[model samples]
Target: MKWTDINDIAIELADSQPDTDPLKVNFVDLRDWVMALPGFDDDPKHCGEKILEAIQQAWIDEVA
Candidate 1:
């Protein structure tokens, strides 16, 4: 599914779903997911940040 909002990702992760598969990306709970990966292997913190940043960037680009 195509997600255009960071909130959705955070919401999914809250359910303990999978986030490894970019296609099945669910959540990015920083507190519970960070330090769970090699370089953020399954690190929710890093993942959350990445997704949030992407969303923010997209929004910026849309207006720019």
Candidate 2:
């Protein structure tokens, strides 16, 4: 998944970190976790604040 794949990445994150709270995650750590995802295949430099925020929001929704 790339930077724009927000929903997919969020789902992966929700499943990977079920005990973690997405809203408490900082952008730096969030980016790292996203990169560490099994199917993630995007360039680190391609991700930005907006993308990370969207991913976090989606993860919040996923876990809700």
Candidate 3:
């Protein structure tokens, strides 16, 4: 999944880190966690603050 696949990434993150809070995650760790997700395949350079914020919001929604 690429950075554009925001919902998918959020789902994966929600499932992988059920105990973690998305709001508390810093961008650096969030980026690393996203990269570490299985099936995640994208150029790291493609990601930016906007994408990270979207992902974090999506993850929060997923778990909610």
Candidate 4:
């Protein structure tokens, strides 16, 4: 997968919940879809390690 692959989280959530309301999807479904995307496929963070690092460092940062 390309390193620059982009994602439309909202759209993916909606598509996965075609029969149900998008806003009402279960957390697991949304999380799974987002994680499955190529954009997030190569994520270096595992089990909140990176997030915990960022939080411990307490530095201002940007996602993209």
Best by TM-score: 3
Instruction: Choose the strongest candidate by lDDT.
Output: 3
lDDT of 3 at 51: 99
lDDT of 1 at 45: 29
lDDT (CA) per prediction = 0.39, 0.92, 0.97, 0.39
Q: Deviation in angstroms for 5 in model 2? A: 0.7
**Every model: Cα RMSD to truth:** 11.2, 0.6, 0.5, 9.2
Q: Write the per-residue lDDT of candidate 1 for residues 1-64, one digit (tens) a residue.
A: 1233344433444333342333333334343442332233333323345565564443334333
The sequence of per-residue lDDT tens digits that candidate 3 reaches over residues 1-64 is 9999999999999999989999999999999999999999999999999999999999999988
lDDT computed for candidate 3:
0.97
**Candidate 2 minimal-lDDT segment of 10 residues:** 42-51
Displacement of the residue 61 alpha carbon in candidate 4, Å: 26
Off by over 4 Å in 1: 1-47
TM-score, predicted candidate 4 vs. hidden true structure = 0.36
Could you tell me every candidate's TM-score relative to the true structure?
0.29, 0.95, 0.97, 0.36
Backbone clash numbers for all candidates listed? 5, 0, 0, 0
